[model samples]
Target: MSWLVTGGAGYIGAHVVRAFQAKGIDTVVVDDLSSGRRSFLTDDERFVQGSILDGRLLEDAFEKFHVQGVVHLAGFKYAGVSVKRPLHTYQQNVAGTSMLLAAMEAKGVDRIVFSSSAAVYGTPDVDLVTETTPKHPESPYGESKLIGEWLLADQARATGLRHTSLRYFNVVGSGTPEVFDPSPHNLFPLVFEALLDGRTPRINGDDYPTPDGTCVRDYIHVADLAEAHVVAAQRLDAGEPIEPVYNLGSGDGVSVGEIMRAVAEVTGIAFDPEIAPRREGDPARIVASGELAARDLDWRMRHSLTEMVASAWEARRSAPVDNV
Candidate 1:
């Protein structure tokens, strides 16, 4: 039996699909190709192109592929845009997850590993966040993810479904040159796009109360994040104890200024980032303690900041101009 990965054509989802494949686990991808690319998946990989809101499509995929578990990553992912379009965000994230859960119940798919967000802790007061950190989601996107976790928990309590949620901040780098991050909203891609187009990369706000006077955020490699999903799924499949939620994060964060410097070094481009006004609702620093995830899922920051930048740059440069 194969595991179904929703939004498997997206960057993180593609890496997760590959991670499961590396462990001799089969995967069937279901993506609408909204923000994901068809080329992100391989020819041999099973793919069903449709929105998760369509319960019939999900049930058909489950039956046809003999699916056992699911890795739920399909949703509207942009926080800034989510603020302007709360209705669309809730529909795609909340309503879509509800539909997927309903389909899973109908098809007897009883396990899931949810792709959650660190946005659930909006501008946390503490220096280092933990699993127990009080959730104060500032955006509709974050609120929807919290709701997704609630759905999983409530479903598990009622239907005996085995599930876990992974909350994380910045996901950077590429596991394979074939699969590069194509997100227009992510920092790495935004910087790379600016550099590729011979434009200066702008730091949102350089006056924050950070060491470098810019916002600091925990950054993890895409491959590492993908591996954590595999581990979470394995624990569920093997009936091993798993936390309802785990934070995959770096206890220490890297400043945006530091990131800009790393980008300059990696790309061999020497240009100071333009200082732009801070966007409203932007936090000064938001890092998390991954001690629990490390203890449970073998989570660790395998790649350094320089490695993260270099790998992302290499993969970004490898992509076609139009795709980037």
Candidate 2:
């Protein structure tokens, strides 16, 4: 039986797929191509083009691929846009997850690794977040993810389903040159696009309490994040006891100012980032400790800030101009 990776054609999902394959585990991809590109996947992988919201389509994929477990990564992920698109976010993240779980139950595919978000902690009051941190999500996007985790937990208790949710912080960098982040809202992409279009990159706030006078947030490499996912899947497949949720975070975060400096250095384009006033509700620092994940999922900061900037810049440059 193969593992089914929902949204496998997307950046993080694609890296998860590769990590699974490297461990000699077969993978099947289910993506609607909403934001994901088909070119990001491999010919050797089984492809199913459909939305997880369609229960029938999910049923068909489960049977066709003999799905053993699911790596559920498909969802409406932008926390800021979720404010205006609350219904869309809930439909895609909360409802879509419900549908996927139902399909898995029908097929007896009892294992899943959910792609959750640190957004669920929404402007956490603490300096370093932990798994037990109280969830007080500020946006519909974060609420949707928190609800998704609840679905998994409820399902697990009712039907003996084995599952884990991974809470990801600012997922930056590319695992391979073949794939790049396409989100219009992400920082690295924004910086790269601005530099390529001959516009100055802007920092939303420069007077924050951070040492560099810019916002500091957890930034982990996509590759390290994906590897942790695969490791979690392996453990679940082996029926090893694992936590219900893990945060893939960098204990100490890098500042936006430092990121800008690295970007300029990596791209060989030296220019000061335009200073814009802080976006309302923007926190000075939001970092999480990955201690739980490190103990259970082989998680570690394998890439430094310099390496992340360099690799992301390389992949962004290598991607075709029309791809983004």
Candidate 3:
């Protein structure tokens, strides 16, 4: 089946594209290349250098291709940056999604798979969060994602547009050597960058209640997350009842100290991390319950922490860097 993957040039989107290609599906990508790299788009796939805010482009893309599904991965995702630049984040994440939904409605596209985040749950008192967890976003980034999901649900209820939004945790790791997030905001990539740059990475907040007094998080490999998106798309394509939301994670939290230890072990780096005060809105612990995804989409993560870090490090070492 043919598909339209918005932001298909970004880290997660690129992995999703690869997953579709493996299944012999012809997927077209529409990316503005603002945060995504043009090099990430495979030669075999059709690529459009554009944004989701462009209604005419999206409509034309729908008309030109036998688009059966749309994967909404295009949005501003930096939590810290979103706190400082709320308007810009909203314009892109919220308004841009509105534009995409409008285009979908105009084109008669009903099925959508949105890339959501764990940030929507804010700081859950429980270690693992389920689909029913209340959305209490602490940052504009999380708020934008929550709004996107709400838009999908509202539009679905109003127009019979089915959707599946997968709220993901820290998505870390690389799918292949050619495609990797060169400058990453996530913990693992930053740590890998620090080691590569011969600098000590800063580990924020070491006084939490967890073991070693550091924060804990769920880190899902990108490949596994991409596969889950495919499953979600397949469910929607089958005209199955949309479950609305699912949390994609490993169901267990890994501490910052544990992650550092794993990185050091993988890279053979003896660098010590500087302990810094916790950033604002930083959650001490955030994991996800994949029971819903498993029940509905049959999704599960296959990579261990060590494997994820090692794969990321390999990409960092060999990945071609484009100076900003």
Each prediction's TM-score against the native? 0.98, 0.99, 0.96
The per-model lDDT (C-alpha) reads 0.95, 0.93, 0.87
Between 1 and 2, whose lDDT is larger?
1
Write down the RMSD of candidate 1 (Cα, Å).
Answer: 1.0
Q: Per-residue alpha-carbon lDDT of model 3 for 86-178, expressed as tens digits?
A: 999999999999999999899898899999898898888776799888889999999999999999989988998989899987888898977
lDDT, candidate 1, 1-324, per-residue tens? 989999999999999999999999999999999999989899999999999999999999999999999999999999989999999999999999999999999999999999999999888899999989999999999999999999999999999999999999999999999889988889999999899899999999888887889999999999999999999999999999999999998999899999999999988999999999998878799999999999999999999999999999988888887776
- Best candidate (score: TM-score): 2
In model 2, pairs of residues that clash are none
How many clashes in each candidate?
A: 0, 0, 0
Q: List all candidate RMSDs to the true structure.
A: 1.0, 0.7, 1.4
Worst 10 residues of 2 by lDDT: 315-324
Candidate 2 lDDT tens digits, 202-283:
9998898889899999999999999999999999999999999998889999999999999988899999999999999999
lDDT for residue 282 in candidate 1, whole number 0-100: 86
